[model samples]
Every structure is written in structure tokens, then in C-alpha cells.
Target: MFLAVGLGNPGTRFERTRHNAGFRVVDILAERLGVPWKSEDRFSWARGVVGDKTLYLLKPLTFMNLSGEGLLAFFAHHGCAFEELIVIHDELDFPPGVVRIKIGGGVAGHRGLQSIVEALGREDFVRVRVGIGKPERRELVVDHVLGVPEKEESIILEAAEKRAAEAVLCIVEWGVQRAMNVFNAREENGQKEAC
Candidate 1:
């Protein structure tokens, strides 16, 4: 069994914010798989199959800072190891519309990831980072992440979410290595020549 976690704060108020990119990607994946979400243990989740592997899509309701609590509960209940988890979250380093998959790294100031690392006491889980870009001014970082994007920016983020969802499916259907090869090297032009 594989656990795919999308990190974001709960509540309708944060629905379309840049920080909720992970939530959007998981929603897309659930829609594509025709799975319905159910509330359980402080999180919303849907279960489905990709190829022959069982997939669990999770969205923690503990907000960004306490995300690890929800993840820990799910892991304990499902007996899932850190290696069997794939966490999706927004990234400020890459430009908007850029998506990358990696395994085991520092949180880079993402509270959601930091919480997860704290809860799990490990950094071996896979990460599917959906870039939302950084703010122009350092002081605007908080507002930028929590702010809704403009129409054009929204389009870019939407595309990134879709691609990120695909990358998650690829991980389950193929494997992490192949998914990284196909997705991490992708360019804005949709070219996969090289990174």
C-alpha cells in the first residue's frame, strides 16, 4: 500500500491560495481515479488503485503547522512506512508551473514538511513539490503563499497541479525512479530532453 499526502491548511478560506497547491493536485488525482473522499481521523482521504498497487490519497486537517499529527495518525493506522509515503506540497524555489519529484531533503522553511519530518522522525519519504514561485519582496512571503493568484497565475498553477497529479500516478504505476526521470526533467515547453 502507498500513502500519498497533500499538505495544506484546512478550511474553505484557504481553498484557492498558492499554499494549497498540494490539495489541488490530490483533488485532481481523486477525480481522475473516480474516488470519493471521506472524512476520517482528522483528515480527508480517498482510496483507489493505480495499476496493481493500492493508493491512499490524504489531506490532513491539522493545518500546515500541525500537519505531522494527521500524518502520524494515518501512518500508525495503516502501518505505512516512511518510504511508502509521497508528500505533495507547494515550493517557493521553482517558478510557477514547475513540478518536481524528489526523496529525502530539508523542509526549506515549509512548515508542513517540517511538521511531517518532526512527526515521522525521518526524511526518507518522497516529495512531489508543485512550485508556486516566491514573492518579489521577502516581507511579502507570507501573504504571497496564502494569497490567491491572478487569473493568468491561476492557469499556470492549475496546469502544474494536473501535471503533479500525473507524476503521482506515474510513481504508483511505474516507480519513483521512472517518475522522477519523466517529470523532474520536464521544462516549461513540455520538453523532456534534459534538465
Candidate 2:
């Protein structure tokens, strides 16, 4: 069994925000798999099969900062290990429209990731990172992530979200190394090159 967790604040207010990139990717995956989400107390989830693996998609309703709560509950219920986990989230370091795969890394001060690490007592799970870039000023970081993107950036991010969803499928169908080799490539001038 594999659990793919998407971190975000729940509600219409955050639906189109940069911080909800993870949610967007998971939604895309759910649609492609033709699975319907069933709401629980701590989170919403859908189940489907990819290859021979049982895939579970989860979106924490505990919001971004407390995302771990929902994940912990799911883990306890499913008795899943950290190795069977994949987290899809927005990346402030990379440019918009970029999607990358990472394994066992620091949280980079992302509250949602930090919460997961705290709950799980590990940081070795796979991650599908959707780039959202960052604000010019450090002080505006919160507002920037919580706010909706501009028209052009929104289009780019939508593409990135779709790519992130593909990355998740690749990881499940193949392996982390293979998915990284494919999705981690950088795009330059409309062409893709190794990163």
C-alpha cells in the first residue's frame, strides 16, 4: 500500500492560492484515477490502484501547519510505514512551472513539512515538489503563499500541478529513482534538459 499526502489549507479561501499546490496535484490524480474522496474527521481521502499497488490519496483538513495530525491519524489506521509515503507540496525555492522529486531532505522551513517530520519522527519519505517561487520581500512570504497567483503565473502553476500529478503516478508505477530521472529534468527555452 502507498499513501500520497497533499498538504494545504482547506476551504474556498485557499483554493487557488500558491500554498494549495499540493491539493491541486492530488485532485488531478484523483480525477485521472476516477476515485471519489470520502471525508473523514481529520482529512479527505480516495483509494485507487496503480499497477499492482494500492494507492491512497489524502488531503489534510487540518490546514498546512497542522497537516501532520491528519497524516498521523491515517498512518495509525492503515499501519503504514514511512517508506510507503509520498508527500506532494509547493516549493518556494524553484521557479513556477517547475516540478521536482526529492527524497529524505530537510523541510526548508516549510511548516507543513515540519509538522509531518515531527509526527513521523523521520524525513526520508519521497516528495513531489511543485514550484511556486517566492515573494520579492521576505516579510511578504506568508501573504504571497496564501494569495492567488497572477494570471500568467496561475497558468504556469496549473501546468506544474498537472506535471506533479504525473510525477506521483510515475513514482508509483516505476520507482523514485526513475520518476526523478524523468520529472526532475529542467525545462529551458521550451526544451527539457537534465537538472
Candidate 3:
């Protein structure tokens, strides 16, 4: 079994926030797979088959900063390997419509990823990062991420969420290297292709 964990804060207050992009993508995946989420031990998850692989979609309920604690518990319960895990989260570095896949990298100051690295004791797991561009001013960083997206940005992000779901399937069907090659490639104009 492979684990696909989507990071986000719990509660309706954060439902539509830019920082919850990972949750949104997981929702899209659940929809596509015709599975319903079930709450279980500090997280909610759904199981489905993707190209002969059993995929477990996880959403940590301990909020963003404590996401790793929940994920680690799930991993221990399921006896899953670190390499069989894929983490999906919002990225502040790229534009709002971008999605990228990579394996093992610095967390770029993301507290949720930091906690995951701390708990996992390694950084070699796969990552599927959806972009939610940074604020112009440093002081507005928190507000920018927690705030709801503008109408146009929301539309873009929603579409990106669908793409992110596709990327997850690509990883399951084709492996991370091919998923990265397909999902991380840029167009001629330097825009990322939505794989």
C-alpha cells in the first residue's frame, strides 16, 4: 500500500484558504476514485485502487504544524515504508497555478514540512507541491496564506487541484521519475504544464 498525505489545518475556517490547497487536491482525488473519507486516529482518509496499486489518501486532522505526528501514527499502524509515501502541500515559491513533483529537498521554511522531516527522520520521500504565490511584503505572509484566494486565483487554484490529482495518479501508474518529468516540465513560455 502507498500513502498519499495531504497537509492542511482542520476546521471549516481554513477550508477555502490558499494554504489548504493540499486538502483540496485530495478531495478531488477522492471524488475521482469514488471513495468517501472516513475519520481515523488523528486523520481522515480514503482508500482506492489506482492502476493496480492500493492508494491511501490521508488528511491530517492535527492541523498543519502537527501533521507529521498524525502521519507517523498512520505509518506505524499500516507498516508503510518511508519511500512509499507521497506528501502533498502548498508551496509559496511558485505562482498560484503551478504544480511540481520532486523527491527530497529542503522544506523552504514550511512548518508542516519541517514537522514531517522531524518525525520521519529523513527527507527522501516524494513531494507534490502546489503553488500559492508569496505575499509581496514579508509581514503579510501569514495572512496571505490563510486568507481566501481572490476570485481569479481561486479558479486557477481549483483547476490546479485537479491537475495535482492527476499528478498523483501519474506517480502511482508511472513512478516518481516519470511523474516529475511529466508534471514538472515547463512550457515554451516557462509556464508549467498541468499533467
Name the best candidate (by lDDT): 1
RMSD of each: 2.2, 2.2, 1.9
* TM-score of candidate 3 relative to the true fold: 0.93
Give a tens-digit lDDT track for model 3, residues 1-195.
678889899999999999999898888899999999998878898999887888999998989999999887777776665347889999999889898889999999898999899998999989999999999999999999899998999999998888888999989877988888877775114655544
Clash counts per candidate, in order, are 0, 0, 0
- What is the per-residue lDDT of model 2 for residues 123-148, given as tens digits with 9 covering 90 to 100? 99999988899889999999989989
lDDT of every predicted structure (CA atoms): 0.90, 0.88, 0.87
Pick out the ten consecutive residues of candidate 1 with the lowest summed lDDT: 186-195
lDDT of 1 by residue, 10-62 (tens): 99999999999999999999999999999876788899988888899999998
TM-score of each: 0.94, 0.94, 0.93
Itemize residue pairs with steric clashes in candidate 2: none
**Candidate ranking (TM-score, best to worst):** 1, 2, 3
Candidate 1 all-Cα RMSD: 2.2
